[model samples]
Target chain A: MDLPSRIVITEEGPREGFQIEPGPITTADKIALIDALSVTGLSQIQVASFVNPKHVPGWADAELVVAGFAPRVGVSYTALWFNDSGLQRALAFRGKLTLAGFISLSASEPFALRNLNRDRAGQIEAMQNYARLHWQAGVPIAKIIVMAAFGCNFGGDVPAAKVVETVSDGLSIAREAGIEVREVSLADSMGWATPRRVAAAVGAVRDRWEDLRIALHLHDTRGQGIACAYEGLRLGVTAFDAAVAGLGGCPFAGQPGAPGNIATEELALLCEEMGIATGLDIEALIEAGRLAERIVGRRLPSAALRSGTLASLRRKVGP
Target chain B: MDLPSRIVITEEGPREGFQIEPGPITTADKIALIDALSVTGLSQIQVASFVNPKHVPGWADAELVVAGFAPRVGVSYTALWFNDSGLQRALAFRGKLTLAGFISLSASEPFALRNLNRDRAGQIEAMQNYARLHWQAGVPIAKIIVMAAFGCNFGGDVPAAKVVETVSDGLSIAREAGIEVREVSLADSMGWATPRRVAAAVGAVRDRWEDLRIALHLHDTRGQGIACAYEGLRLGVTAFDAAVAGLGGCPFAGQPGAPGNIATEELALLCEEMGIATGLDIEALIEAGRLAERIVGRRLPSAALRSGTLASLRRKVGP
Candidate 1:
């Protein structure tokens, strides 16, 4: 199937990928990787998260990394924020940078408590308040990622009805605040999604929010990340969040459990092979994978990095 | 969709699985693993290959493993053979046990020459001759695995038309030999399949041979093996070839490059989750995975085995 020329790839290696690594990565290395990624044709780069430093020490240098990178033209550098306090820090940069706010509807009570320290209704209210405050300050919220839209590591399977209800609630709040939420991306935080489940979830969301752009933030914990992306692409999802070299893992999911997000190179290869136009340089993306490995001081979880692509394999074997 | 009461699982850990491992598994360990797997609910097991021992020392114990495993009543154990000479050794045990002949059809010339030392037509003629001899001798050929039916590691894309042509050729030869072929299976040697591609291949075989019993042998190298199985199951396939604990790798595909077959427990989980019954105990299967790992002196490739199943996870967390 033919795809759009301008595919939006949001790099999540810095925030999501580094967040799950066992050892701590230096601020300098993280900044260097993000700086390198900015020029690699990515439309959006998720630089860091403003969560409690104790909770995710990997992103303790969130402010430094975001401030250090020399923002490239046409690239939207964004960060994830949860509460009003987090939103306040995000809004400090305001017009100077693009920012993304995250609010998760606790698909399950345990996940809600663990992630947001609130119930489903309480979390929605919090997100609504944050969105309103951000709009009042005249800051555009580029996107809001609804975490655990598929299933939660703590909460098992989140009902599709709940996700739709949660999204509808958020959308209503955004409308009330007079803020045009550009995109509402669903995250399979636990990587429990199957292709059929992914298709159903994306189809259901599209059915409800006809005009809103959809993006998928997938983890490869259970090895269904790419399969989910394949389903999403078939469902006409144009934007996705991926990690270079598939480096990211969910911190809550614990060690070696939550694999990195879908690798950018694998995603590109999939698109290219299917006759879809994803204007990213494949070789450069592979180089990015290796670079990610160096920054992390360990091997990245990318399959494409380990197994060269068909084109590269052919070149090596010599046709 | 409702599935049949009885499902056939062909364990390929010994022959198909071990042949791909980097180092040779000792003959004693192979025999023990095969013996352990035979007691499981597997209906058929491809114990070993009769290929040249010098080429694949891993299978040098092919004869020993077959003899060591005490035959069970409902289980049909078989070995893979690449040529008529291999077929002769396979037939030597004709009265002693049931065996299946295996051949690979190359969609490209180079792959055919490298793998089987013959082209597609030559392989077909050899298989026909083997079938003729097996028929005259009253040997029941349990199954015939058409390797590289999806695509070859060396040959790139194997066109669906070529696969259909090969199937037609096999059917004609079976008809001429006056022997009713029990089962015909396709092997995705390189794991380069997409769900849509799997569906198309299975659909083509089903459409052409209405009475044909189709099985799928897949590798998890590209992480699409399970997704491919899900599609294959949707396409009405009832039989699958899986390795215990995902213990094997494709030797030719290089280290960390070729993953093992789809894990038996993972496949069983998919079947159970989809409301299809395979009459296999998942916990018992996991035990089998551990057993395989111990014998191989390394970890298996099974995700479910490494990460506890949902049920076990719940039990561990004490829901």
Candidate 2:
């Protein structure tokens, strides 16, 4: 249970957070917020999702957002894609953005169909197609996100074997298509994972693919995200995905009451307190949360923003 | 970091939760809810706090609530005490309720004075008096809770050395008064503890006091409660205190926006998923959350109650 000395957090507020909002946030606001987050010492940020506007109206201006975004010197900006059309939209960005190709596989066929518009095999095939197209276009597929890796909304008990199998199949397809795979991001889309479950999955994958970099995209829908992240860190999976202010939820989960991704501020505080070097300016992160609250016109569920950081708390309550 | 086979979870909704609430929840409603929780495989519940009604008006009817409470066999009900008068009130219950004595302390003098109306030394002296009185009366003090064990709202950075020193001083006083100490519960009163901090404090205490049982009373204000609990578990500390539906916040923290205790239902789900036996009926616990929401006339912050537990999730998303 030895933890890593450092972890990489990827901010996903602009895309995931904004997509679940009731109304569209102005492109200017998105650009401004993303720009603000770019300097927060995060290694990467998921700026926007290149999905169909008909499906998610809030992200309709993805192109404009990506175009207007000004990346910080050391931080890489990425976007998400679901299918060929989404990939095409991302490819249109050419070398401007690092495209994070997504393949959501649920051991449950119904969930796989409803969420990914394909069964497990079909989804793997689509990923192969996705890899082939990127290869044909001479573009690199930076990462393939295995969504619902823990458990799915329609699929019960996504076994560790299934997750490993899915990742292996996706990677095998990429190898056949001659596309070099960068990493695999295991997402707890339903927020159904616990620490032990995370340990088992991450351990199994890490043991099998020793050299592959593993990342976690966890949600706090069931209040287990932070604990899961701690377990992931113990397992030495460094990259994590979080949203500012706990801002996003799965629009497809049919549960509006579900919580968003783990708050970046909270995660930063955890990392800092654990002696893990996140290099995040928590003051800047809290300010970003405040800005998000102002833009969303409501209170967010981020605890660190409301409670203040550990150092601030210590100073505030000091003698 | 081997986890225990099982952990003890103490439900504190009626006592801690009702105390912070604005309106009066009738004795009948309180009795009904406690009775319902009694059958949910919970070993213990803090039914009421014998504090002055003038301070926490919601728990004004502590005597009446205790009188009306119907405890099931094998379930131990306890009441919290601040001073001798509260102890006298708890003593009236005689064999019916286990008395839990509380002494609020802070390394910060301002916090100790403002919160407890006494400095740390004075608070320890009062605990000694409480122990002598309880022993002379032939009544056992089931547990002593060290409030603000991590950090205080007014006292910043409660060092591990300070926590150990406080506990040692309190224990020394009890021994001098010829009282036996059964357990020590650490309260993260303002919910500022991170996992490593919890590890440090719990590890220090466990190393120093190996035979004494350790428990954690955690709040989720900064969204690190479950992870702290995990760290405590890893350190071989088993017992945890949680409100049924994330129900209680510190009225003394000055910021009402701070969150409540970690939800019992959520914690149960974590333990169940981790193969750590809690013996809690999560379905019934979630029902308790619903009932709590009904009594409070608002939705609680418990994520498991909102999104459903792992079993329920698997069932709902099953073939």
Instruction: Write one digit per residue (lDDT tens) for candidate 2, span A141-226.
Output: 76667777888777777778877887888788888988778688888878877888788788888889988899998999888999
Task: Report the C-alpha displacement of residue A26, candidate 2, in angstroms.
Answer: 3.6
Per-residue lDDT, model 2, residue A214, is 90
- Cα deviation at B194, candidate 2, in Å, is 1.6
Q: Can you give the DockQ of every candidate in the order shown? A: 0.29, 0.71
Candidate 1 Cα deviation (angstroms), residue B161: 1.6
Q: What is the TM-score of chain A alone in each candidate?
A: 0.91, 0.94
Residue B251 lDDT (model 1): 64
- Which pairs clash (backbone N, Cα, C closer than 3 Å) in model 1? A17-A248, B20-B249, B20-B251
Clashing pairs in 2: A317-B156
Can you tell me which runs of candidate 1 are displaced by over 4 Å?
Answer: A1-7, A88-97, A297-300, A314-319, B1-8, B35-40, B70-73, B88-97, B142-144, B254-256, B291-300, B314-319
Candidate 1, lDDT over the whole model: 0.71
Query: Model 1 - which docking category?
Result: acceptable
Score candidate 2 by DockQ. 0.71
Once superposed on the true structure, which residue ranges of model 2 sit more than 4 Å away at CA? Answer: A100-110, A317-319, B100-110, B317-319
Angstrom error of the Cα, residue A246, model 1: value is 2.7
Report lDDT (Cα) of residue B40, candidate 1.
72
TM-score of 2: 0.94
